[model samples]
Target: TEDVEKIKPEFVRSFQFENKLMPSTWIVIRIDGCHFHRFSEVHEFEKPNDKQALNLMNSCAVAVLEEIQDIIFTYGVSDEYSFVLKKDSQFYQRRASEIVSVTVSFFSSMYVMKWKEFFPQKELKYPPSFDGRVVCYPSSKILLDYLAWRQVDCHINNQYNTCFWMLVKKKGKSKSEAQHYLKGTQAQEKNELLIKEFGIDYNELEIMFRQGSLAFWQKEDKNMPHESKGSVQNSHKKVIVEHCDIIKPNFWEAHPSILD
Candidate 1:
């Protein structure tokens, strides 16, 4: 018995890889939809942006925040969402695999479970899946930058897609022609093209389409018993979703608890 026990841990250790996340850092788990371009096409999602699809993603993010006590904030755009855990959190003993897998799996599950709510008329042809990875930032500043960077990307990609789809849908341009037309186009040129060609002012588009979305607690969640298993927190403030500018100092200043 003693001999077997002695060799067992050693054998397991030999085969196992170290996947513990760095300690004392802000942990981020980003989940991206796998092959979502096809997912959207099969589902007939509106070109550029689908408000219902985005709402479904946001709802899943909120569900994850509710389920995971360590996750404090989330930002989502397109088919991806990033969950931010508290810097000092020792969730799952800082195991990278656990952090990524648990959050991402829960998100995917919620996506399926809530699919009908967001798409009441359409049948869910197939379940969607996501891939996740974990990264750590040493300080709050870099973490904020990480989120801001994603928001900027949201702006860039959304602008391009908007123009691309307008060309295809409105002007009867082929995908190839649209892609070629937008090549080497600057932001100003894109804006002008939208105005001159489509008579659409890019600035007048919906705020949610431009800014993406964020999910966070408006107030500190009262720490609940481990046995509590409700989707919604009992606290006065449940997870709130907002499509707001996270790039500015004013946003961070207003919601200090997110970084604090």
Candidate 2:
């Protein structure tokens, strides 16, 4: 029994590679679908924007936020999502592999579990998987910039896809023709095409399509009956979800606690 208690500690220590994220920093774990183009096609996702698929993704993200207390915020577009851990978090000792792997695995599982809820009529041909990576930001400014970059990318891609699908679905152009027509066209040109050809104003498009989805916690008070009749109990904090424009200064100002 004494020898069993004195077993070598190196046996466990050897398994770790010391891939720890820096302390006093923000940790971002981003997960993206692998070969999702084919997956989306197989699932018969609507062209340009699939509301059901996007909703499914957002639901999965909500599950992640509810499960992982350290993740203070999340931003997701298309088949990718970025989860931001609180700057002072010590989850899994800030081990990069452990945190990234577990978060992505949980997200993937939630996606599968909720798929039927999102798409009851459609059958899933195969399972889906996401690849994940971890990045650390030393300051709030850098993290803000990183999030802004993803929002900008969302805007650009949504604009292009909106035009591409318009040309294909409504205009009766083939996929290749739409691609060729969009080639070498600037954002201004795409906007003009949408306006002239499809009578669509790019700015008027849904914010969720142009700006992506932002998930964060909001504290609210819910009144409950106390032990005594007609007496109110104390309020507590609850995490709620929101989909809005995070690129604006107002959003950052409103949720100042997220970065802290």
Candidate 3:
């Protein structure tokens, strides 16, 4: 029993490495606002009235986790849920658009059944759309920190939209530069540059950007000020950026291939 306990974590790690190939990038799946408006009519009856809603939401989360078992290694839940995927896994190679498509379809089917079961008589009002962003990164630490930040944002904002961000390192660039590049600067020009350099269609790239998501920035604009006119007002913006790096993939290394 002691041996089993000691080896369990190691075994899990080994399995992940063997299957995922030491992930060169981080793949994040984030779900926001999974539960809302379970029971509105019975405001006085709290326990039994709300139980169904809680159960339905839990079931939906389970369904989502089960569906993505092949790709996700570890996950966490709150108002939002985040799943971290192994790098170099077949899942990472898939087009970002495909990832969102599959996720939406699965949620749609699961939610339909769950809603019907929970609210059979009254017309069910679906919660806000489960739109989310997907991001990939090269550093596990960065990805984990980003996930923590996302959860905090969701809790504070009371909004339903979710964002996924990934960090992928350029083959020969220093990690610091890669991190800066991933932060997304001059996104419009970057998008155009990527299209020109890679010969990928601009429209398709836009779709990938939609699925892959964007970065969040807290900005203090010179044009915008606080009501008092003495303090600076800061605005948060979510913007998507994509571009290639100066670093070239090693000829002998198996790097992630961009898919259409």
Candidate 4:
């Protein structure tokens, strides 16, 4: 009890500081179920032991980490094998969409492959193939609150739920402004009233961002004397937009393939 008391204050302080620093940090959380069918198919193949379960969990975490690394350049893993991106700067619409799509596809593929490799003869089946849903919000506090709620739901429902959430922010907006825009009464109402409001076709944005457009450039002389001839130089900085994640009820339902 004494130790808990000592830690509580520190934890609160840390959270407060984080909220202040990145008030508008938006998180995208993807929750996936792993090897449900395989587990049932190979129920008798491996003994139900804590050590074995832990080993399997560790392996799954490693696989997820590897896949995430392959997709996103800037990301970190939490202790729970969940992925997080803090203060992410790459907010180009294309980049954001690519990150989400690649992550879902990669995780789904690797999860299936890993299960097959582990239980070669189990003949496991996957539910309708659905990618994990992405939840976006403007504040970490709200994100954590939503995660906690989902955790409770999973516990009560006895469902296999694995989540990968990313924190994102718009490039130009101040953290407070972003948070205000996301959390304001009108915005919240809009989000609540609209079904599938967060759903977006990121692939289209990805292709558009990749296509470069023309821009004007000035010429400068290099090889010739300063007065002789002029040379031209062209440069472009990728355009990126900043945005955050918000919580949506029944995110798993959005991706019926994985959930089913």
Candidate 5:
């Protein structure tokens, strides 16, 4: 018994590691799909934007919020999602690895489980996986800016992909040809090209595709009947999804509780 105890401490000391997130800050755990481009091609996913695929991602996000109460918000696109834990959250003792692992594992499992719900006709070809990382923002403004950056990235990528796909799918150009055609094209040029060649109004495109999806709590009903004091605790949150501009002040003004 003495030898076993001495050996355990000597071995565990070399391998034990824990990186706690900074206190009084917002924690963002982002997960992106691994090799999803090849996976999407293999599955014949609709190009530029796949409604069902995005829907599946959103569903997994909703499930994450329902399961992880500390996570107050999530922003998700095609193959990636970011979970934002509250500023004062002590989830998993603020350990980065635990938080990242829990969220990523649950999200990946939910994605696999809900695949059939979104794609009933198509069988899942193979197991899909996600990679995750954790970062902490020192202030709310910085955190919001991080989200805005992601939204802007979504807009840029969607615009490029829309043009690329239009050229390839509609004009019958090869992938390389499409890339060459769209090369050196600015946002205005791309918009004009879409309008003139494809009769597509970029502004009228789906908001989710342009802005990605943002999910957050919608304030639980405090007036609801409860059997006892213990039952008054938040049984569940009212999580809502929006596909609108979070880059501007309008969204934050409308939902101040999201930051509160």
Candidate 6:
């Protein structure tokens, strides 16, 4: 029994060297699905955009934010999501590995749990996994910039994918031909291609695909009435989800309490 008790301590204690996230800094844990392209195809996801899959991802994100009390905001697009923790949070003693691993694990599990709700016709086939990392931002400005950068990436990639998929799916162009055609195309050229060739205005696409999904804590006041009496009680605050653009100053200005 004594040896059994000591069996794992030596190996387990070795993990104490894991790096902890910096205190008094923004903690961002980003998770991205592994080999999602093949996964999407195997599951018969709609090209360029899969509303059900996207909604499933957002649902998982909402679960993470709801379960992880310290998380302040989240932004996601395509197969990736980033969760922002409060700057002063002491979650899991600010352990980077624990925080990142737990968030990703929870998200992956939730995704699987809610998959049937979104795609009732498709079988899961195999388990899905996500890779995650924790990044620290020293200032609010840098944190804002980090989010803006993700939004910019979402816009660029969506535009390219829209064009590439359109060429292959709608225009009968070979995949290789589409890739070659888009290789040197700029944003303006992509816009022109969408408009002139497909009669689609790039700007008219769904904002979720172009801008991505953003989630933050918004306080809602609820007046509770005591069961014994007929009088209303004090306001109770709750958080709700919002999908919007985080790159603009107006958004940050509108949610000033987030900074506090």
Q: Which candidate is the best by lDDT?
A: 5
Residue-level lDDT of model 2, residues 125-171, one tens digit each, is: 99999999999999888998999999999999999999999988898
**What is the TM-score of candidate 3?**
0.40
| Model 3 Cα lDDT, one tens digit per residue, 28-98 | 76655533333243222132123454445445655665667444432323323454555655663545666
Lowest lDDT 10-residue stretch of candidate 1: 225-234
Candidates 1 and 6, the one with greater TM-score: 6
Please list the C-alpha lDDT of all candidates, in the order they appear.
Answer: 0.91, 0.90, 0.44, 0.36, 0.92, 0.91
Clashes of each: 0, 0, 14, 11, 0, 0
Model 6 over residues 128-159: C-alpha lDDT tens digits? 99999989999999999999999999999999
TM-score of 5: 0.92
Better of 1 and 4 by lDDT: 1
Displacement of residue 41 (Cα, Å) in model 2 is 0.2
Decreasing lDDT order of the candidates? 5, 1, 6, 2, 3, 4
Error of 4 at 165 (Å): 31
Please list the residue runs of candidate 6 whose C-alpha ends up more than 4 Å from where it truly belongs after superposition.
1-15, 223-234, 237-239
| Model 6: lDDT to the true structure | 0.91
TM-score of decoy 2: 0.91
The better candidate by lDDT, 4 or 5, is: 5
Instruction: List the candidate 4 regions with Cα displacement exceeding 4 Å.
Output: 1-24, 33-58, 69-83, 89-96, 125-128, 159-260
Which digits, one per residue and each the tens of the lDDT, describe model 5 over residues 92-164?
A: 9999988999999999999999999999999899999999999999998999899999999999999999999
Per-residue CA lDDT of model 4 for 1-260, tens digit only, reads 88876776766777642212232345353534455345443444321122233233335544554444221111111112233344342433324455556655655565466655565555544431323444445654565565555444433221111000001121354545544544534433433422233343322322212111111111233343344446333333221111112134443244332211
